[model samples]
Target chain A: MASKRIGKQTVKIESPVSIAATAAIAGPKEGDGPLRLYFDMIIEDEMWGEKSWEKAESKIVKETFSRLLSKADKTTGEIDYVIAGDLLNQCIAANFGLRDSEIPFFGVFGACSTIAESMQLGTMLIDGGYADNVVALTSSHFCSAEKQFRFPLELGTQRPPTSQWTVTGSGAVLLTNQGSGPYITYLTTGKIVDMGIKDANNMGAAMAPAAVDTIATHFKDTGLPIDYYDLIVTGDLGLVGKTICADLLKRHGFDISDRYNDCGVMIFDCKRQDVHSGGSGCACSATVFAGFIYQEMMKGNLNRVLFVPTGALMSTTSTQQGESIPAIAHAVSVERDLSS
Target chain B: MYNIMTKKEYEKYAEKIAPKSNIVRNTARAFVVGGLICVVGQIITNFLKSKGYDMDDTSNLTALIMILIGIIFTGLNVYDELGRFAGAGSIVPITGFANSIVSPAMEFKSEGFIMGVGAKMFVIAGPVLVYGISASVVIGIIYYLLNF
Candidate 1:
């Protein structure tokens, strides 16, 4: 009845993308040694005012890529290319930061899912023999972003508990034709999805429909059961978004309960952090992918990851013109190559 | 297993990390001061209600009051103490944003708007508000594209 009512066929798997390296920067305390990220690019929230968003983003990206590229150990003159994007306009933050570095670069955007989309594109590019090394990048700035879209930070607006934090950081991942690492196994193309949620302050409710679409597509294309991957991760659907996505999938007869989780909600343990539902932004998934999950993968605690990066494709202009939020999500599965 | 901290060890860690006596007293003081902030908010809400403002307006008015309180606490060096005790409960949302705005506004009073108060104000809350508004608007458009 619902399928007939919606009148849309389910989506299927198209291709997959690989992940190379992931890195994040955040504030630091010496006691946070075990949990300390390599770059303690701690910009206190108060100090993060409007201008700082772009500055911090540029700095994080520039520093991170510079460090990663410098360490790439280019024996042959075959240096890797960089594919990057951000939430900022024209991917300006990434463009400005990555410009100085001699990496062959192209900019892309997938909203919060920019990192995953870039990764998918990078992998496809490499697989197609277009390029061997590619880097995907993304970032979010709380102040400049707010002023451009909604009210200014000075408005001191209140947020609902269902809201997710927009991480004030940037992340970069380097993909290459390497010897040993996780390979991009498959990816499901995303379609625009919207379920009539209009309130700009409430995002989890907004992105849920896209999450449902991509997750369902992954199942259809791969013909793989939910249990196939060790963990099925969703990009920035927070607590509320995750719940809605799960319900929508269950209705489609593919249960993703046990293996399903969202990056937004997984970051700060909302109750402890008062981050409401969880974390959001390009950095939301990027930081977690680089920080916690990367460590786990390195330690061999888990392997074979199916990551579906979800994006909400809308801007302030479209909203002001009375448009609904259209969302897209790309699914990329990564697993350690046995040859390594 | 020896490397891993046990429940007992965690308990000890928590105790060791617990706020000291002076810190607890200061936090209590800060909470009392913070509670006064709510009192001010209530007074504003009541005053707005008396003027026949709607609940939404009154609530918004309360939020503004809270931000002002956050600024005062921060200036007085009491906001950090309040944060230690209330954890994110005190600092996460409104108060947190309040700290973000006022701290800079107070820091670079000379730089005025672009460089100082106006420019640096949104550093912390900017991303939250941006994603909040952007996500909301995007979802709205998706709804329209799929429907209207």
Candidate 2:
């Protein structure tokens, strides 16, 4: 196998799974953000004329996957497998989205960390010689997520300040055994970490410790210095979680303050947008990386990026039953070999 | 990745650090909004009373009018925005109760009128009704026992 399991939870891939292509579709509100220009498509209507938000989310997944395949100049038949997930019950968006594609599918569920989870699995399948090409994607709709996890959309209730808005978008990335250079090099699987946080509204604080744990584990297992990467980004730690994550990293003897960023915090201008904390959900990191960071890497602005997608794995039932939020974060190291 | 803190300690620490909504601002907004809702009711009451309706009819009419406005605003999708800005101002009134019921009904309409709208209509307000009625019954029983 080309992929070697390293000390503890890290995996080192010898042949490096190349990122063939990436696609992202953002909602109108996200299109107005700083990363707006990076998205392939900005949907003007939230529902996109669909009868329901769930169907609209599935359409987003389908379109994003189609665009990714087209960008790579490969048909669905040419791909070995498609790994996808979403922040919906039964992973409905992914299952229904790719049903007609006829490609072998792997439905995953890691809550918001689904992007990194899918990408890691896809890269492993390729590096292990089980497949030549694989597509990894995830989607999250703000309305659908709120309907399933929080409350009805029309509920006249105020959002607390610590709350993060679920990002309305979808992103897909194509990974192949052979391609010109930006490659996925390492993977660090995360363990469920709970700090007794029961408040569902304050997801940022709940998910931050998990990010801190995974980041610290990755560096320890790989024996890599914090300065090795140009950027260390988390999935949806928003402003509150991002700050706490940085602080915790410093305490872990890894002061990753300068080059660190969070997808949730970056996706929206919280100060101006009034989104309380910032953007979240499965698509937060997915769209940000597929649209913004990947473009920055392709532009030679960044050579190495440690992408960590965080998830708060809790249901309304679990929270209502007084269970703490169990959070997880998976990390992948992607480096661009531009000189070659 | 030993966090060096107990779960309870971490919970307390996390709560302390997280940003809190400005209570004073929220309270002020709620006060203004709730007071205005009451003022609207009072005006409606005065209007109906001036037209020779009894106090009982005027009060009931005032509640009916406010509830109608609430449902209308909810259907228009503008009440949530007001609720967001006004906090509990739009929530503690008769209209808030109407929103709590009608909002879920409209949202769940996709599931079908019988299961979705009818079944889910009272999800948010169901507890309020349950506890309110239960408390009233308990108080009535206590009063009867005391009289006996």
Candidate 3:
């Protein structure tokens, strides 16, 4: 048997998996953010006539999948598998989102890192020659997440400045063995790291070390220079985690400060939007990547990109029980053209 | 395993990086909002008393009216916004308690009235009531024993 393990926790694919098509949708507030124009669609009504926010999120995911299929110019019959996730409990959003499509679905949960978790799995299935095409998608809604993870929506509780707003959006990506130039070249799976930070509101602080650990591991395994990638972005570390991640990376003896960015920070102008820390949730990185990063690659602006979606694996029950948060991050490297 | 720092040291480090909540501003806002709520309660009490209501009846009526206002504010989605700006100012009053109950009730209404609104309405208040009643009973027992 042959192995594609590159180094420690990293994997080198036998052949590049192509990123064929992508779709992203944002809620009204996100649609008004700095990356507002990047989303394929912006939903004004959060409920969208649905009785519940969870059902509305499912609709968002379903629509994003259809848009992804249309962009890829393929019907559901041609798609082999669907790997998806969300911030909802029991992964209900993804489960119901793809239920009617008749696609073989794998529901994943990595908290906010769900998009990258699904994407990496989709890449593996295609590269392993087990499937021709797979769709990876994720969604999150603000109201649904808040009610589930924290307080009731109408409760007059004050959120601290470090608290992040769960993003209201969904994103889908189509991956195939054969497609355009942009390719998935590397993946580094992260280990759960708990820094003993107990505050659920400061997710950035909780997830930053895991993101930094994965980035450092990727560099070590690949023996790549820090300047190799044009951009290195984390999933949703927001303002605080981004700084901590950078400082932690510096301690690891690598500096990509000039190019380091976070999806949570990029998706919103925190100061103006009044999103204290920034945006979070599974959709934060998903919408940013599917809509913004991939489009930038298509335009030849970013040739090499390191995408690390970070997740805090703590549940409300765990947090209430006084267990500190355990965070994980998955890193996937995409290049415009592998040959170049 | 990722770093040499122990969990405690790393936690301390994380604490250093995270931005602190503006305590002075939050406290000041909470004070003003709480004071304003008290003023509103006083006005209602005075008006009710002027209408020939006794002190006890005026106090009870004022609390009822304040709770009603809290419910309306929560329904109109204005209380949460005020809560955000004023921190505990909007949350430390009788109106805040009303907002807490009505807000959760409204949020869970979509889950259905039985398990959703009915069961969840007392999530926060349940503990308050349990402890409040229990402590009152304990104090009453102590007073009775002393008199005997």
Candidate 4:
């Protein structure tokens, strides 16, 4: 049985590991990432407990991880490896959370592209018959991010509508090789595209072209039609970027508007969520992919999928130096058979 | 390390300079910096036109050029001085980012990039740029589909 049911197999990804993230540093650091991120109950301290971004983000990742992983199967032994990273210096927040996990880990920095990067690597290792299971995770916090890169939130600054809310959460997916899980079949590394856009408030527009380019490439390489997959999702392009992605695909002769959606927009209902525009950060796309959509696909709601996570490669220096915004996005194709 | 005087300390320093300073001279310097910034922007706009860019494209080009000029001034330590005298006249728009970036860069030049310059640079601009380009491409596509 060579398996003609590759595309229909039901694959489920779960998080049985528990983690708590808290930001340790609350003070400001330019381009520093977030200040305070911790797990468990956040201790509201004068310096950083409540107002410190470092503490908040650290707490978010830790708590979110703890909540997700607490339900994991205990027999899995020590986590083989904690594959994670953040935008901060040394990715200190990620480091803080993973330090006590007892599982060996490696730090990664792909900006917003971190979720897919980790997922691709984790999936590959499992597919190659190397590891039976792995946990892929990432996160970003607002306060820590602000102190590292922009004006402090205490400064009472108003962000433009194009700005994205850095999600204060962490997501983890337990990928196993032995289980009848959704097999991540192919992974495509995306190229960086700079459309000469510089406004920070308008990330969706800058990143949409990259999303289209990657999606079109995925279809071209796989010879898969737009309708082949139940859904084609992109990471964190918010409402504006999601719209741009749909139109660009249509222009390329691929009709995907009907089945296509974005994690950035889906994570937060615009009107109800009040997450101006939509969600972003490592956790924004990670949680949506690992939690909501992954659950849907497992329940036979969504079988074939194309997960494309996008990132913008602009630092404060480049923006200040008057360079155009450059962006990058990656896509992964996964298929599952329900009737193994 | 040069101790940057706080606002109160700067007030004390200002008193010492006030007696010898010429108000008209300061006003003229302010005009010069402001005028120069505009001149550079105009030159960029005209250059774009000569190169066959449309009006819309030229406006975008002009904005980009102005930002670059702002960055250059910010780098040379001149933008800050001009800004101090011009108030919000120079602090508005992309020029503010330029000033914000250059000051820290010059301060941490000795620390190298990983910590000093690279890490501290995106304080105000990172998220904006991240979401800006990402959203634009998406919006551009959406517009094409609904309208096209």
Best by lDDT: 2
Compute the lDDT for candidate 4: 0.63
A4-75 in candidate 1: lDDT tens per residue? 112233221122234555666643221132334443345555234444556656766776666555555442
Model 2 chain A: lowest-lDDT 10 consecutive positions: A1-10
CAPRI quality of model 1: incorrect
For model 2, which pairs clash?
none
How well does candidate 4 score on lDDT at residue A224?
Answer: 65
lDDT of 4 at A61: 56
RMSD of each: 14.4, 1.5, 1.1, 19.7
| Candidate 1 Cα errors over 4 Å, as ranges | A1-20, A27-51, A74-78, A338-340, B1-148
Candidate 3's TM-score reads 0.98
Q: Which is the winner by DockQ between candidate 1 and candidate 4?
A: 1
Q: Candidate 2 on A257-307: residue-level lDDT in tens?
A: 999999999999998988889999999999999999999999999999999
- When summed lDDT is taken over every stretch of 10 residues in candidate 3 chain A, the lowest stretch is A1-10
DockQ of each: 0.03, 0.80, 0.81, 0.02
Show the lowest summed lDDT stretch of 10 residues, model 4 chain B: B10-19
Models 1 onward score TM values of 0.67, 0.98, 0.98, 0.60
Tens-digit lDDT track of model 1 for B23-94:
555556557745765676788899999999999988988797777778887788666555645544465557
Off by over 4 Å in 2: A1-3, A338-340, B145-148
Candidate 3: which stretches are off by over 4 Å? none
- For model 4, the stretches where C-alpha displacement exceeds 4 angstroms are A1-51, A272-274, A338-340, B1-148
Report clash pairs, candidate 3: none
Each prediction's fraction of true contacts recovered: 0.00, 0.76, 0.82, 0.00
